[model samples]
Target chain A: MSILVEISENLQRGKAKVVKELVQQAIDQGIPVEQILNEGLLSGMSIIGEKFKNNEVYVPEVLVAARAMNQGTQLLKPLMAAAGVKAVGKVCIGTVQGDLHDIGKNLVKMMLEGKGLEVVDLGTDVSAETFVNTAIEQNCQIICCSALLTTTMNVMEDVVKKATEAGIRDKVTIMIGGAPVSDDYCKKIGADIYTSDAASAADAAVNVCS
Target chain B: MIWTREQYIAHCNFEFTGREMFCELFGPLLQLEEEWRQQGASEKEIAMTAFDWDYVLKTGLPCRTGAVTGLKPIILEDTPDHTLSIDNMGRKSLLHKKAATIPLPLEYPVKTADDWLKIKHWYTFDESRIDYGAIESRKALRDKGYLTLFSFPGGFDEPRQLLGEEELCIAYYEDPELIQDMLETMADTAIKVMERVCDKVPLDNLCVHEDLAGKSGPLIGPAQVNEFVAPYYKKVWEAAKSFGAKIFSQDSDGNIEPVIDAFYDAGVNLFYPFEPAAGMDMVKTKQKYGKKFCIKGGIDKHVLRKEKEDIRKELEYKICDITKGGGTIFALDHRIPNGVSIENYRYYVNLGREMLGLPPIQGEGWQRMAF
Candidate 1:
């Protein structure tokens, strides 16, 4: 098997040390930095993302695999920057205002990064104005909002309204996901997208950008 | 009409014994107490009794010098905006005062086996913690027609909350022995505490709080629950049963359908706040489980936020069938939210009573969860 395949397998297994070593060996083999990043590290995470969406794996498994991906990505960053390989899309994400829950938002952020999308996470309890402003300022293609409470999920409507008011409504795709958020809610609020879980959210974000 | 003592007791025993409400919604009710009274609602104080766990165990651990099985929460700092405190679960948090929600956890106390061992001594059997005088006073109040319930914050919820969800889940994989040790120790603590209380206190019911589910399903799956949670519950129910405890119920939020059978098997006959939004349907659950399991709180709470037609439709859909099932309690699936206006709540309550064949409460409706 190729060294790239080994790196992907080790990353999936959450073998961080083995991933780092294999990533270095691939670099020694003079493979393109983008190939190692896209085919090796990212491919592993994308497979895990599919597994997660399928319920073949769960939160803990997703979390550890993300950790392995992070470790390998850290090693590749400097080289990838030198090669001038840009991300497929720029996305800004956060939990909506008055909602302090971060688990869902964090998972979505990780999955987006795993899909080779550059993600700017604004963390939890972010206001509608901030979500719109950050997306515009950062030139992000997508803005994702998360909420855990039925009460707080109403804030997503404000996010949609504010994005429209800011005149960036056409430029950015607003994606909302959480326990209370449904496709009907997304349609009701006039947001661009609503995916049930993080993996699907990343995939949809990628599709929106394309 | 004034309710007789037996009628009230039956309400508390067989029907709902109030519900856990959000402080935001509860705050306004306190202001309208007098208005409710003028509307013919009865006000009664229920006496709660329990052996002081700290005084009994006498662990003398950390800041705590007594039998309380929980951590000796210390106020590390306080400010108008936030209060940084180490709570009883041994998790340090900076509580945001304005939001009235829990503070962010800065650190968890028990991460390893040694941490569990350090806390283990706090739950030892302490005879001195048993307050006979206190037990007698509560029993006398019960005799005088006051509702009395022996509530114990159980093992699974507290342990998981204290340990932090991610850390505990990691510990389940990395250190199964450590997780088992903590749970078994906590179970023993609960058994010991209840055993001592039962020896002296005569209570109406044994209520255990375990918020273990979420909107999707049980936070921990059935297999994990069977391994870690079920045994502890079995021990608790068996212990309470031996004490002649008549009613054994548990309060949990979210869709608990996943673990409902496991809970029933472990002797939890009653479950509360069957949150409809979380996919808990009173009629279907009643059908599947039959009359063996008692259910509380299945009314769609969101109806109050909508129009009166919505409220009527939701109640008419859920109430008649659930009430006929014999063990179903007529209450909102969860606490009334702040979105529910006093008028809407009053209407909901009056409608519920009308469906149950009880007289309508006067203007403003009843405040407490009473007959």
Candidate 2:
């Protein structure tokens, strides 16, 4: 019956309206914004993320849970800003060039955002230079690339090369993922990380950013 | 030597499904036709060439129905530039000009049971259009010695596409009846169209295009598939068979391992273009369901871009074992993209022939029968 647990449970159930109401109530009760964010919304989302990674839940569950998280995040954003609190990390993500598939990329973006990360969604068919330049320009701590096709997965290599050329290769962790991408391909491309699913990608992004 | 139709059919166990060559790539295929003629290759010598219902079907129902209802697919946007448009299926999609193969669906028309009811009205078969002449036209193709393969929309892919994947997946739990209603509507239209086609001409084979999987596996898990897709498939398959459908198959893009058995039991005896990138293993699949179900595509299309030897190695594994008893067909898991040079494709095809103890196709790049 604890306030945070209630928020977490409501968020997990994808009762976005309920989660938002509880968050506002908790705020009125003088609960710390950071605690509500980390313990309530993000905690619920992290569980959903793990379940998604484990294949116990699928995309729709993750999407609705993330929606609830977003509802709670919106109510807390003004307070967090007023309190001088900041997002955990900033990252840039996109589907690689020649690959127009964005469902996987969008899923990863939502998961990262649910984890309290500021994600700059570069969208699908993004060039390697866009990813590299955006990372440098935005001071992103990580560059995440996704590709759904084997033919376009090589574009991830170009992204790594672009980051290296931009001279932020060491500063920004490069994460590659999608159906055809593998750990071997990640290593071959010299990317820092590769995760099979969106949740793991988000989990890795958090680690890389921190 | 040119092979006879019976020998070719026996060699591959009637595993041939027609091509889905991109609209743009049709030019290249036509050009290849001229080159093929110059090289002394007869019409029958070209295995990929075929005339089928997908190209001629008037009512786009059961196969890409966006254009069938007399609605021109308004190009809401142009491609390679995130061209957004409402496709023929009353679904909004972000289509790319370069990759015109599959569009990313953004909005779906049917989500709730109410939505399903409204959309069901759009799936009407025009009896005037479905007259005996429709079958007569196809029968003419069959009379020309071309094997007549017919296809209709499998109930699942059409409704899933109409409802978008996310909504459809969630609807399985939230509105299972809505899913059933939409599927039943789809089967109704399919049975009517297919019955007309079957009543007119003997169907040599049937392909139900269901791109219902991601790279990993079925978008919806096996249980949902059994509950939602299986019965609809059984209904359509039985209707198609009653008229005279010899070979039945499902044309899905991604790994279908979860629903492979379910599809086989539903009378879809063949699964085509088994995408290797999606973890579809021909060797393993054949080892398990080879006797009951035949497979068509397993060669990873990406391998064709690699060195010739790499392409050979990719084909070598499946050529002998899978195709030993005419239970498998040699094809890219999906369409051969423009990225795959004509030379590579010709090489792959000739290599398949060489392995099958058939004569190799002789040509060079941009030359007769080459890229």
Candidate 3:
């Protein structure tokens, strides 16, 4: 079987070890790094994301599959780097200021990374200044802010305002999400986008990045 | 006879007669500040503010119209400063710094057997920390009107916090003996703490806070709970009972149906904040547990943030359906997030009172209830 197909199968079954082994075999077999990534690991993750969106798989399953995909990616990273492969997009992400909750944020990050976005994670309790600065430093095309608390969600506006004040708002797309966050909130906050779930977020990120 | 807040709320509703009007109290945690910020709080920029204990004591209710206060040590330093970030899809992403403070057993606490031994000495019962004067004031306040003491830090999930999820999982198989020892130690400490606290204050009910489940299900399976959690809970419950505490309650977030039997077996007579995320149908739990258990806080926090009409509908559905048969108090399944407008919260509270047949919150006769 093709190495890409094997990697996809491993990911579907959540066999991290098998995925890792198969990726190594593919690399050893001289499969192009990008091909292995796109057709193998990324393809598998996309399927997992779809299943997650449909509720065919839940958090644990997603986490396990993500772990497997990550393992597979590890084998391909050096090869891809050597081949001068660039990330599909550069995205800056962080939990909004004053909010330290990260479970949802982490999941979204994993999914985004799985989708081949070069994510600049700003971590939890991120200040608006930090997000703006990171976006500039990373030359990011997208700025995503997460707030899990109603109190902290207000920071999304501040981050957007800061981006605007810095004259970087038009330069980058701003996205916000969390449990308390909604599309209405995103619109109200003047954010460019909002997604309720991680997979949707990843897909959205991919669309914007592309 | 000891009167619980549930009983008091019921009595004020005229569901019971002559039951004292003890107000329910929820302890504030530092985590709430982050939750509030995530919801878009703009007022306070500071972390680790103290909760207005005085305000809570004065009002006789857990409701407070001021800034929440609490101190939480940072646990993760290795992670970045941002709490939540969005991805390219405009989806918010979050990463908890490794430096973020975790519950003791779960993240920050004793990991190895040796670490346990070192920390064992710190667990000694400290009586001086017990504010007998405050307890006396609370009791006096109860006499004048009604007051309920907030729950302390004992619950099924507390030990898990101390044990850390990953290590605890490993300990279950790799080191059962150590796990048993840790549980025993926790039980001993819990019993001592309860005994000390109750000695100072006559508790109507003791709430044990633990988030045993997530949106999906319980963190630990039923068999593990039976083995690791039940015995320690029994110890705490027994200790509370000995001190004349009437209700031994647990506050766990998520659908706990899978472990409801374990809760009952552990002598947990009351359960609060039944999260609907795990498909928690309070009406079903009430039917299953019946009078054997008293439930509090089954209203969905998410729904409370909805439009008034929707909020009212949800309130009616939850309160009417869940409490229809009996043995339930209407409360938010969790803390009322800041996303829930104050107006909506008041609506919920007032609606709750109306449903319970309690007097209007603002009135001359309000002094009569004194809750």
> Could you tell me the lDDT of residue A132 within candidate 3?
95
For candidate 1, the TM-score is 0.77
Residue lDDT tens for model 1, B252-339: 8777787787777777777887778777898888768666766666777767877888898987888664455246656676545545
Ranking by TM-score: 2, 1, 3
How far residue B231's Cα lies from its native spot in candidate 2, in Å, is 2.8
Q: Write the per-residue lDDT of candidate 3 for residues B1-371, one digit (tens) a residue.
A: 23434455343233544321212234223354555556554332212111111111222212111111122334332335434433222223344433233311113455677866765544444554345546666666655645454344444454454555544554565467776776676566556655655565555555566776654355455666687778777876787777766666687776567778877898877776776644687777776665677776666777766788887887667655436434565555654454455455557666766665556554211111111
For candidate 2, give the lDDT of residue A74: 88
Residue pairs with clashing backbones, model 2: B62-B153, B66-B88, B66-B89, B80-B97, B366-B371
- Error (Å) of candidate 3 at residue B87 is 34
True contacts kept of each: 0.08, 0.16, 0.06
Clashing pairs in model 1? B53-B67, B53-B68, B54-B66, B54-B67, B54-B68, B55-B67, B56-B126, B56-B129, B57-B67, B297-B333
Q: Which of the two candidates, 1 or 2, achieves a greater lDDT against the reference?
A: 2
Query: Candidate 2 on B1-371: residue-level lDDT in tens?
Result: 22233443343353433311111112232234455556665455344442110112111112322114555566777744457888776667776544344677777776567766665667656564354535565566556544556566665677667776666666675678887877776677777777666666666566677877776556665566678888888887787678665567677877677777767777887777787877898888877765676676677877876789989998788776545566665456764443455566567766766675543344311111100
Docking class of 3: incorrect
Top model number, lDDT: 2
Q: Each model's DockQ?
A: 0.29, 0.31, 0.08
Runs of candidate 3 with Cα error greater than 4 angstroms are A1-22, A35-71, A83-86, A165-171, B1-117, B120-181, B187-206, B212-248, B253-269, B275-293, B300-311, B333-348, B361-371
What is the TM-score of each predicted model, taking all chains together?
Answer: 0.77, 0.78, 0.64
